[model samples]
Target chain A: MRASLKSFTPLILFLGLVVLLAFGLKTDPRKVPSPLVGKPAPRFSLPALQDPNRTVSNADLAGKLSLVNVWASWCVSCRAEHAELMRLSREEEDLQILGLNWKDDVVAATRMLRVYGDPYRVSAFDPDNQVGIHWGVYGAPETFVVDFEGTIRYKHIGPIDRTVWEQDLLPLIQAIRKTTNGHE
Target chain B: MNTNPAAPLVSVICEIFNRILIPIAPLRAILLTALLAVSTASAYTLEAFAFEDPAQAAAFRELIEELRCLVCQNESLAGSQAELAQDLREEVYRRFRAGEGRDEIVDFLVARYGDFVLYDPPLKPSTYLLWFGPFLLITVSTFFLIRTLLHKRQSPDSALSPREHEQLRELLDPHGSDRDGRNGPDQDKSDRER
Candidate 1:
């Protein structure tokens, strides 16, 4: 037993180190798990990006499955994710894409929307990022999947491509829908 | 003096110094002063947040210094120039001004950003590996180390027997066994003569 244990020690340590290093290499350091998941979405009322007279708030996200996409005109990833957002908006009629125009110039945000078809149901203008602070928004191109009851179910950091929408977001949305339907 | 190898080199170096270095000394000083001024101008300036007391200001500084900036992973909330870091600083300042203590402020940040915001992570089930993994590694390695050392100490191959010692001595000094055992003092004199 002692001889066997001695022989296995180097092999065990080598395998363990390989596993640890591979895991580290595969994982993205920037993708931090948000504590906001499973909690109610933070409340905020801000002026609409396009029409300053109109307002969008947490109340707007109520009684519907909403994808609160935190984006900005200055963010490159936001532009990258625009087509996906537009496609999602088109496909999922029930899914409301509530935009949080985080820390961006209003004119530029409006121009961006006009140029690349507006995917948002109603975009909230947050110039000073007061609402963003409450939402724990560190970077742009973050999307929060809020359930019908306004509880945040999932948060996707970085640009959302077609694969991400199908693989991660769709399954979660379907699961939430099934549960909600069963309860009702 | 002419025979000295470095004489020509030294005179040439002196000539170059007189022709170049002395003329550029004032210019180098001016250039150095400009560089110093640029560095001083670009030094970090803390955002002016009004505080009721000096104690509150110190606490606020300490709080931000501990909080990690999410945008720039390595920078603290106090040091990062990222807009998100600025927003976070403002949030901390707001909470501080409202008379909330350090724990409460940290808790609030953790609630939103998760434990990643804090420089010092709390002792929890999730963080057990992060906190104690190094010590556990040291302990395991030390156990193996001590075992190897003890094993080495007990190994018979390392210790020489009487016969092996004699053989080694003969091999090292070929004439020692043939020479007089009492005449060992004269061995060195014989060696010198040879």
Candidate 2:
């Protein structure tokens, strides 16, 4: 037993080291939940693509139902998503679709607008992509639906489709609109 | 008009020769410095997929980090984060791009470096114990701990020595079986008490 106790201490410590290593390996970053919900819209300003003198700011979005779609010409999926944006702008009432062209060249973004026909109220060019990073725009063509009350209500990470609009988008707008009217 | 180019050349050569000699360690250091400078400018070329899709990039990261580097031992390609591990990860991505299945990738790795690469070694005849080693270790340890404790409680040799017995006797009685062997009067009393 005397000899056993001497060896057992090291053995127990070695086992502990194994457990520590297992815990260490599991310690990578987990998914982050978005904090944008219930908070006021993040203030931003960008140069309008078509008209350089006319800039769009968060203040411009006051008292309206609007969507801020982050897109770029270089992004392949943005081409696939052109028509849906036009359809939303055409069909929806009091729903303004604004474009945020992130990390794009002026010429390319302009060409994209010309090719696809601009669906936005006015597209803004964010050359340095600072705004995209702030919005957690990890990819091109992400959409955020901002309410008239200046709160970002919804986020779409990829291309928005009919299924997403029918299932997620339309319901969200109706609910927010209904709740706000009750206050009146 | 007394200008010989060789005369000036000889003086310059002498100055250079004076500065050129060094201890062996310093010479070795100079050589190593030159080697490092050469390598600094050497460009290493490699190809890796730059995914525009964040989902794909996330998936790629998961696969690279989780998968063990076959060429290296006992290191996850992600955790080691070595150049060889990076190369292996790039290879895995290439295979992923080619639409190779997971089994095909694993097979490729196992072919290159056998079971030593795997952290969770498979349970076959050869590695049956390796796969089950931890549980077996815990079981053996538990058995030994209980056995050691029980042995201490029950073993006859674990009892107090003769010297301890004498000390106990002295403690129990002030005059313990001494002085003219008359039992010290209290000796029998003490024994009876014990």
Q: Pick the candidate with the highest TM-score.
A: 1
- Residue-level lDDT of model 2, residues B73-122, one tens digit each, is 45686665444465566667778777776668766555433444455567
Candidate 2: C-alpha RMSD after superposition: 25.3
Where does model 2 sit among the CAPRI classes?
incorrect
> What is the per-residue lDDT of model 1 for residues A1-184, given as tens digits with 9 covering 90 to 100?
9999989989999999999999999999899899999999998999999889998998898899999999999999999999999999999988999999999998899999999899999999999988998898989999999999999999999999999999999999999899999999
Candidate 2 chain A, which ten residues in sequence have the lowest lDDT sum? Answer: A28-37
Number of the top candidate by DockQ?
Answer: 1
Could you tell me the TM-score of candidate 1?
A: 0.78
Poorest stretch of ten by lDDT in candidate 1 chain A: A129-138
lDDT of each: 0.91, 0.73
DockQ result, candidate 2? 0.01
Per-residue lDDT over B40-155 for candidate 1, one digit per residue giving the tens place of the 0 to 100 score: 77554674777868888888998899999998999999998777888888888888888899999999899999999999999999999999999999999999899989988888
